[model samples]
Target: MASITLNKLVKRYGNGKTVNQVIHSVSAQIDDGEFVVVVGPSGCGKSTLLRMVAGLEEITGGEISIGNRVVNTLEPSERDIAMVFQNYALYPHMNVFDNMAYGLKIAKVPLVEIQARVDKAAKILELGEYMQRKPRELSGGQRQRVAMGRAIVRQPQAFLFDEPLSNLDAKLRAHTRLEIQKLHRELGITSLFVTHDQVEAMTLAQRMMVMNAGVMEQFGTPEEVYSRPATTFVASFIGSPPMNLLKNAPDARPGTIVGIRPEHLDITATGWALRVDALEMLGFERLVYGRWLHGAGNELVIVRSDETQPVPGLDTIIHVTPRADRLHTFDAATGKRL
Candidate 1:
């Protein structure tokens, strides 16, 4: 395992007149054996950042160092890093064993050592039973495991995952997420995962970097980022139903907006009255969407509820209250946390 560091990293396209600067001056340190996730919406440059670290993309400025070596100029193969892409890039004609052992073989590792490494990786990935199966014969989850197994044998200094679970169904995605967590716990290799899924970031990362339109918004633990979001975009982006932005609130400062999460709201008899407009039943929990009474612009707010709790009917008026201390304040003009 090795520590991964990025200092003032930058990426741009074209040059001069048509130059489109994507990734800004981003910097962060990923400690040895730590799993860091870079997350954001599409077109946020999350993948671009990962590829930069992997040496697949050129860095227009700054530096990326894996362990003690500056890798900005190193070839992908020379960086001592392994990447698992979104699409399980396995050879359809190769059996599980060969696919996993192919890299080692190409590197000229002794056949005996390659066998040992493949066996160990297969066992760890629960792919021992499928070693003889080709990619076409295995399930989606199994194919993904083969991809992971291929990376595992490399035992690279770091692992780069670009939405490795994106191709799986919801249940398989959850299962693979647990498998990944277990793998990281056992291997404890430095890892960087990039994804647009907030839930994945929240569950898999020791510390996560939140990106927005080529800029680094916040870098912190899932708890820190979720509990005290660094920006309005984060407040709105990180949560399931997102935070309620009392845009143009009567009492808010001219350029600041008040933020409150769905789960932080309560139905009270004495608080602000909300007219229920919609309901989303999510098994054991429910989400109530309503607009504030006596407020203009149809500004909606969401309130999370337990299945056991009763919710108001649509168009019914119910009072909702926010935990004052949990309120987030952000600059409406700049979207930065205030």
Candidate 2:
């Protein structure tokens, strides 16, 4: 296993006056055997950042180190990292065993050692029964497993995953996520996974890097990012229904905005008055969309209520109070936590 480090990494396209910068000066240290996920919305340069670490994209400026060596100029093969792409890039004509063993064979590893490695990887991935099956004979999940097994057989210093679960069905994606967690625990290889799914980042990361428009907004554990976001973008992007940012909240300080999560607002007999606009039933809980009737008079707010709570009628005025300890204050102009 190896640690990966990025020092003020930058990526730009074109040149001179037309240079379009895609990645700003981003830097982070990924400790050995740690699973770090890069997550953001589409076109946010998360994938581009991952590709740079994998030695696929040229770094416009800055340094990338894998283990103890500077790998900025190393080719993909020379970097000693295994990459698992979204599409299962398996050989259609080769059976599972041959496909997994091909890399070692090409490297001139002893035949016996290659067999042992392939066999061990297959057992770990639970693909022993399908060792002789061609790619056409396996399901999508199975094929993906074969791809992972192929990477495992090489025993590289680190692993890179580029949305490896994007093609899987929802149920299969959940199952594969568990398998990946187990794989990391057992092998303890350093890994960097890139994805747009916040749930994946929240569940799988030992630490996560949240990116926006090529700039890294925050790098911390899921709890820290969710509980105390650094900026308004992180606050609004990390949550499900998102935190409410009210510039004109009744009790908000001047020149500051108030942020409250949906679950932090409580329905009360008397408090801030809100006119109910809509209510959504989500199995175990409900989300109430309402318009605040004070301050700016039209600020929208969302409140999460459990199934036990009585549903408020639409257009009816209801009172709610934000938890004193749960309220977050941010600078109105910068959208940054104050």
Instruction: Score each candidate by Cα lDDT.
Output: 0.92, 0.93
* Residues 1-338, model 1: lDDT tens digits: 79999999999999989999999999999999999999999999999999999898999999999999999999998999999989988988999999999989989999999999999998898899899999999999999999999999999999999999999999999999999999999999999999999999999999999999999999999999999999987888898889888885445787789998999888888687778999999898899998877748489888998877786899999887788888889988888888
Q: Which candidate leads the pack in lDDT?
A: 2
Q: For residues 68-186, could you state the per-residue lDDT of candidate 2 as single tens digits?
A: 99999999878989989889789999999999998889889999999999999999999999999999999999999999998999999999999999999999999999999999999
Best by TM-score: 2
Q: Supply candidate 1's per-residue lDDT for 136.
A: 96
Residue range with the least summed lDDT across 10 consecutive positions in model 2:
291-300
In model 2, which residue pairs have backbone atoms overlapping below 3 Å?
none
CA lDDT for candidate 2: 0.93
Model 2 clashing-pair count:
0
Q: Could you tell me the TM-score of candidate 2?
A: 0.97
Candidate 1 matches the true fold with a TM-score of: 0.95
lDDT of 1 at 329: 91
